[model samples]
Target: MNATDRTPADLLGSALARDPAHPLVTFYDDATGERVELSVATFANWVAKTANLLQDDLGAEPGDRLALLLPAHWQTAVWLLACSATGVVADVGGDAARADLVVAGPDALDAARPCGGERVALALRPLGGRFPQPPEGFLDYAVEVPGQGDRFAPYAPVDPDAAALAVPAGSAGGPEELSGARVVERARADAAARGLAPGARVLSTLGYGDWAGLSAGLYAPLAAGASVVLCRNSAALAPEELARRVASEQVTHTAA
Candidate 1:
């Protein structure tokens, strides 16, 4: 697929088509010493299903704010894609402040409720064992996903000038809003310039929440139909572990 024909959804679809069975994301469960792998097809399907759930089940409309506070797990990828597919404005919020909707880990959810209260409409808890009880009106994400349809109709063509993400301004007292279409276009161009192509694997020492790292590490490779090997906090990993993961994953590029 050419750059002109690709959308965020199409990028994921291409990855699924190219390497349906290949592991797209791998994470270690420290408690069990178990490795969890999410394949390209599974990732794509969850993204689509989440998009449908947000739009159809939760009544999230285009331009509505959807704040994400989950860890850098497989679900983070799903939330990013689902927001793009449904045209909901995705905001990466810190532990404080109120957002229209919040997707968080159990601890974050509890902290947010006292701050946000009735202002928050939806509280999506991550899928795992022993999460905090959501307020009476909040919904369970695990149950919500199964109830949603398998697919979602794509949003109308996105406006290049419209705000798509609002990133927190590091201790600056305000967030920096960005244009989605512009970011996507620049990412595609950067990917092409860097020779990030299909089948190649890219790694990032920075977290996915960083603007440049997120664009280059996650979206850029996906835009080029390449695989991404993401580490939430690469700086925390031991040298041997990092080297082993890079070699095992066959990472070709590193963007810090």
Candidate 2:
């Protein structure tokens, strides 16, 4: 099907059905010093799991904002895909203070609590030690939300023109909302126009929170049913390290 004919659900579903074993995401874990890979099927499951958590547990009704402050991790991609399927407005925030739900590591979680807002802490054991004890009345993400189920049923189809995400307005002091489906459609068209194949591997050094990051790094590849190798610490690392990772990962396309 053409890009316009597919929703995020349809795209992901097709990818999973066509090549469930294909690697959808690959990331380098600094702590483990190993590259972690998640296949299309595994990614679909995590997206479903995240959808269940947002819709069933969080009571995040359709059109409700579900902000995230996650770093560039596999879970971040899962949450984005989940939001699309569940009809939740997934807002990617630049900082914890701006987000409705912050899926952060331990240090970011600690720093964000003082902002005094509702947030969800996505616990990654590899990110750090066990979850730190929250102060009085703070929500512990793992404790509050039940584990996601095995199967996920998507919500009703969304209007392509509807607002899908909210981004920070540059120097404007407020958030700017954008159409999710439109962005996906455009990106898909662009990728196809560039002759990108379904399973092509892409190297992206964009930060996870920004527009380019979300688009080129995550959505673009997924929309095209391709693989993405994301470098979260691109700015801090040397050029050689970046080159090594790209070559090692066998990246076919790059948005560097």
Candidate 3:
């Protein structure tokens, strides 16, 4: 990370400033045989639009807690940075009832129903398609996000020391919470451990259910000015297919 990047959003901005056209996050759904790649500018646009939707449409404010029940898709990565931009604590797999807002995947809708706050759902489609039927008490994120402003300006400044993330107790790894500064610190450390350098292409098959997964699959590569190749349901891929993917994506590092 650069000297000025104390938060994930700042790290993203630095990446954007360095190379807006460079590919940032490339996502694959092994089960669906789908792939989507977003350049730095494209990813920033998505993050900005999502942040606007959270702040302007959903009325999210600094310190608000958002329960994010999503997977390792590109949209989930977008939501992470969006929450950072808006100062909303990203509670991954958190308690829905206590959230100020909830963003759930298709499988997570039922679990998110208890949230009294504004709720949104992602179809996790190949091209970000909307659900044929919106779940009860939830907005369609794909439909709502595209209409939001292209740029985001937070209503209030985020406190780097304030709580920024919560990894709920889970089977993967968990029951941990962190401040914004700590999140950045951890990401930086993970990048170093992963031996990620600028321009590195790191492939990760980690989920988004815990801090370890988030650090390896999203924050670490992003913090290092490297790009990510995030694969969901990767275990379903045959060995040959996985090898082909690594070769085709020009993967320089691997995190499983």
Top candidate when judged by TM-score against the true structure: 3
lDDT for each candidate structure? 0.65, 0.69, 0.91
Flag regions of model 3 displaced more than 4 Å: 169-174
Q: What order do you get sorting by TM-score, best first?
A: 3, 2, 1
TM-score of each: 0.79, 0.82, 0.97
lDDT of 1 at 218: 64
Point out the worst 10-residue segment of candidate 1 by lDDT. 117-126
Q: In lDDT terms, which candidate is top?
A: 3
Higher-ranked by lDDT: 2 or 3: 3
Candidate 3 clashes between residue pairs 3 or more apart in a chain or in different chains: none
lDDT of 2: 0.69
lDDT tens readout by residue for model 1, 1-256 = 3455334655676677677886665644333444556778877778888888777666777777777766555567678778777777777764435555667654456655643522232332223333255445456576567666766676566554566666676776776766666557766887887788777787765555656756665677777777676565455567788789879878888776
What are the per-model numbers of colliding residue pairs? 0, 0, 0
Clashing pairs in 1: none
The RMSD (Cα, Å) of candidate 2 is: 3.3
lDDT of 2 by residue, 1-256 (tens): 2444445666788788788899988876555564668888888887887788777776666676666667777777877777777766767764555545455554466655644445666565443233566434345555553467867875566665677766666686766776666767866876776456777888887777566677667777877778898766557667898788778888888886
